[model samples]
Target: MSLKASDLKVGDTHSERLVEDLKRTQLVQYAGASGDYNPLHTDELFTVKVAGYPSVFAHGMLTMGMTGRMLTNHVGDGRLTKYGVRFTSQVWPGDTLDSTATVTGLSEVDGVKLVDLDVVTVNQNGVEVLKGYAQARID
Candidate 1:
């Protein structure tokens, strides 16, 4: 059954964690796929030497991808109207990440119902890494 926008309830929480850690190969694959080769994200030596970063970091889009997919996977297709996110912290390989979302508000406009989400991502240490809002149309 398709979950319409109104069907999304507020005060609900869905979360997933990365205790296994993200692999370096996967991070390289993401760099190749997303075409975001910032030295801090692709070149470990550059990240350490030039950028003073400990290691290459995962692209923020990669994490946000999981977030959007989580919503669509739960609600079904053609239901997203607005999706936006912000990277609050850097994600490195071996860092376990947990992503979650909760409904914060709902509205209807021009016959389309819209829902806003309070999305967040945390690492193994419980540090907040990413957080943002997403708006989608109810199917």
Candidate 2:
């Protein structure tokens, strides 16, 4: 959907699936793509035996990147000026991520329109994985 700053109102929301039934292969692929080759992300044995976690979990940046994908998909590309998130929980295999962005503020600066978004991503169990805010220019 094309969203204009002038047309957006506080509380307007956009939601989409970020990832579904997350798998080990996807994590490995992400590791390759991002060069994050930490064994904790790609090697279950290292994660469970060495790191002492119950199981391997996703890399924080991978989740953050997924959040970015959700944001761009909702509001369109090249508009995001600022986007950030706090990693709140581990995303394990088999978890599905549902992402949402709510319009929180709107403003204009030097004739540039801006839209502020409150963004969040939650797992299938409704546990928040990432939460943050994003600001984008609306052309």
Candidate 3:
């Protein structure tokens, strides 16, 4: 459903659990689908021995995509006009992720109602893994 400008205020928020107990298989699948096999994501041995990470970690894009799912769920399909994010931390297998979108601004530009949102995704430990912003058309 579309959001209405009149029904929203700055600081209003929507949140969703993006993933529970993330899996390595899912990371590998994302690697294959996105064609981003960089070994850091799918090769535990290389990630640990070569890259010196604790283990193979989730791709930043995968976490961003999961956060996007939350945004689309809140704002509805095809409503987004702009979206961007920054990766703040690594996400590992078995971690749970929760994403939140907070209303930052609402306005009518050239008769088109729009909403601005500040997006954040955090892990089970409450560590932010992704941060970003999005703009979307609203009713």
Which wins on TM-score, candidate 1 or candidate 2?
Answer: 2
Quick one: ranking by lDDT, best first?
3, 2, 1
| TM-scores for every predicted model | 0.87, 0.96, 0.98
* Model 3 TM-score, 2 decimals: 0.98
Q: Write the per-residue lDDT of candidate 2 for residues 1-139, one digit (tens) a residue.
A: 5577667899999899988999999999999998989999889888899899999999999899998998888778787999988999999989999999999999999998889999999999899999999998886
Model 2 residue 54 distance off true place after TM-score fit, in angstroms: 1.1
Q: Is candidate 1 or candidate 3 better by lDDT?
A: 3
lDDT of each: 0.77, 0.90, 0.97
The TM-score between candidate 2 and the true structure equals 0.96
Clashing pairs in 1: 5-138
Best by lDDT: 3
lDDT of 3 by residue, 15-99 (tens): 9999999999999999999999999999999999989999999999999999999999999999999999999999999999999
Q: Rank the candidates by TM-score, best first.
A: 3, 2, 1
TM-score between model 1 and native: 0.87
